[model samples]
Target: MSQSRSRVIKVHANDNVAIVVEQGGLAEGTTLDDGLVLTGAIPQGHKVALTDIRVDDPIVRYGEVIGTAVVAISRGEHVDETKVRLPQAPTLSDLPLAIRPVPEVEALEGYTFEGFRNPDGSVGTKNVLGITTSVQCVAGTVDYVVQRIKRELLPRYPNVDDVVGLNHTYGCGVAINAPAAIVPIRTLKNIALNPNFGDEVMVIGLGCEKLQPSTLLDDRPVKIYENTEAADPDANVLSLQDESFQGFGEMVEGIMAMAERHLERLNRRQRETCPASELVVGMQCGGSDAFSGVTANPAVGFATDLIVRAGGSVMFSEVTEVRDAIHLLTPRAVDESVGKALIREMEWYDRYLEQGQADRSANPSPGNKRGGLSNVVEKALGSVIKSGNSPIVDVIGPGERVRKRGLTFAATPASDFVCGTLQAAAGMNLQVFTTGRGTPYGLPMIPVIKVSTNSTLGQRWHDIIDLDAGRIASGEATIEDIGWELFHMILDVASGRKQVAADKLGIHNDLVLFNPAPIT
Candidate 1:
């Protein structure tokens, strides 16, 4: 018999199981708080049954039913996917609509950050010139032009933070007229209008692409134009196939000329004092483990509440991750309309998955299971906590701009890259991403603050992680401590006084549009 002391973490008072906190695992016959003994060896992060459960009984965590037992589970035995069956999805029609009252939050006063004030009353943490492209065909040429702008022109603009080509795989070889095509097209347009870009819209286009530059910016606002007849005097367009440019040299020159003008405008902007309310923060999780809900996520939730209290905006996305626990959200909607809107997005996604012949089970990847999440139900319960207890002020579809402040549920795919890009399109000026297995995910246009879910991952990837939320799991810090730290960190990043790990290492993932349309 082994004499090792092991401890378990119970998430809720009603939970019949608790997580094994011991490193590696606990062997059989291990003694517990009440003289109960482990019936078998349980792996770290895995659940240990605290009471006998009959077949078909509900498995509870976070005070909610995560799943139902598929087999009889006895005390001290391990509980995992093999022993549980996922429950059915919540029905949309009968979901409570805005039953919960809005949280009474005090206006946070005297909180300020140094930021670049935009002409549209927005604020930017960084002053970067974004070069938007109409289609994928011109990406190479646009990239080349960006390089030249950086080497030959960027140095002259000392105030400009950076110049990046907002290049993406869209605009060609697709059904541009299709109803769903509007999603990606609108996404590109909105990304160009992101606050960090400072309202300077410059478009590079392949003259033959289905998405013409004119169509992309048909009625959008702009800041740079050479003619009075232009719809947007502030926006400039460069068509590679224009008759004025006969050769590659002339094409490059034309792009360079337009770039110089924008760079000059961007360089003239300076950081000014802005309120915390000007901040729009995006919250997400990836590479999640069992400790995710127990540690990092709850910390993020606390921070989300702090942001809401400060009168700032916070967006929590990943539709599939929220689908199962959506019942927990409808009642929190600000009103009946907001609750219905939430249902519409969920129902739409259900049809989307059915069309693809998949379901929520397709979620909870192998890594999640290995990390002790049995199915989508468990993952979702953990995922939704990042939104905290804030009321759902609004719900927006993919790529749609956020209209209301407070907590907004921006519907998006769970894929890290795609969700990050969509959040940017939705006007996220900063991002907080928590991970367990770890991902070096970041966006060039915004600061991404990485939070680790466990101390082991935090220490191993110390250089890349901005905050070690693992302290909550290790008992070194309280959730409130990490939450306050994160809140302060957001202000520091917004003020440009600190740089996130992703930005320091120059690790940026490409923009991946959530195009649900077919390519014809």
Candidate 2:
């Protein structure tokens, strides 16, 4: 293809660089539509300088400075990480707060989905029997029982979608009373209450662990149900280390009995039509690339706006991912308190990273660089696009259940598993994850809708990717088109009318707790 016809995506007219969009990138001597000649071969997704830049000159994209040029670069030269120096993160102080009026948009109405409504008024996308464990010692027992429940007992409860062991590495050999311990404790507690489990709480304990059953359920809002009455909190708990259990077989039998009771309750529950306001959707992006901002993330952002207009709750997280772009976000907060809360989370994470002797530059992994992101600054700009233009109504610390509707910033590590786990704990019934590179990440407690940023990854991982926003990059579809399509797919998936690629393949990642507390 001639260079003039070859595509390059320039995010902003002021940007001095644009990413090569051709599948194999462009060769040296190729000319762009604007008659700019490539100085060297540029890889797809990699940046090509649109203007000659002097050393220390700002490297702009997305209408913001992502970095500074470390060496003089001619126009059309490939702008890789080696040629750029990372910029300082935005200061947490003196930021804009609610300065711009939130644009008035037509309210989206009449959208509904069939979901299982819990007694606490939460909606569930899946009816699962979540077997919780107080300590890692009971994981094996829980896992074994989960298989038995699925094979021997689940068949009896046709309404139960799946049996999942809420397995994790916390609850033992740790500083349970530490200040930071609340993160993991509340995370596990809230995850058990995740609407998907149908409010049936059962616990398996090892009898000796730092995080005890009562402690785990302390002050919990929902009660474990036994028929019409509240069950003895202890009645639902099975300790494998209990003197009454003589052996592993007896232990397994004990768990199965408790599970059957919960399954019976869950099996009787049926899907009911719930208004869009009942939907709690989490927005996240991983395996990102330049196209992430250009396509999938932008499309997800549009869908996020739609969900907000429909009166639903949406959460967008990844603390480090938002740190650099926080200046842009703070002004969008609905009030001063919410904006400060955003700064607080950022400050906390900054100290956390400093204590560990690291900084934000550690992000944008090798794969990220290979995908054309020069540094965390550039990556953050793209990552925040998933939030769209919604005014941030609230901000919660890691593992805290969301308290407000519309868009809330749920602070979390950028790790895919940890973020998904925290979002689930925050009561997200469904997650919309966008990716430029591919990932098979999914959660057992909720439905995850995977969106591919580029058609290349979408086509290669066709079965694993639920939707392709790449059509936006190819001009085959607009962001609003994919946004509406995704919005509809979400309702379908929530109602069980459709299954996400990961769920269809039974692919799920383990729940990784965010435990900043020290080990014993």
Of the candidates shown, which would achieve the greatest lDDT relative to the real structure? Answer: 2
lDDT of 1 by residue, 1-520 (tens): 0112365778888888787767677899898876768899888778888899999999998888988999999988999889989999989889999999887877677788899999989889999989999899999998898899889999999998888998888998999998888789888888887899998889888879989887768687433333222334245887788776668888887778787878888988999999888889999999998889988899999999988888899999999999999999999999999999999999999998999999788989998887788899899999999999999999999999989889999999999999999999999899999998888998999999999988878999999999998888767888899999999999999999999999899998889998999988
- Candidate 2 lDDT over 1-520, as tens digits, reads 1123678888887899998888787899998878899999998889999999999999999999999999999998999999999998888888888776888999999999999999989999999999888898888778888888899999888899999999999988999999999999999999888999988888878878989876667775433323213334346666777676667887777777778888889999899999988899999999988889888888889999999999999999999999999999999999888998999999999999999999888999888888899999999999999998999999999999999889999999999999999999999999999988789999987999999988989999999999999888777899899999999999999999999999999999999999999999
Runs of candidate 2 exceeding 4 Å displacement:
1-4, 220-234
Error of 2 at 330 (Å): 0.4
Q: lDDT of each prediction vs. the true structure? A: 0.88, 0.89
In candidate 2, position 435 carries an lDDT of: 86
All candidates: CA RMSD (Å):
3.2, 2.7
Candidate 2, residue 439: the lDDT equals 91
What does candidate 1 score on TM? 0.95
Worst ten-residue run, lDDT, model 2?
A: 222-231
Report how far off residue 295 is in candidate 2 (Å). Answer: 0.3
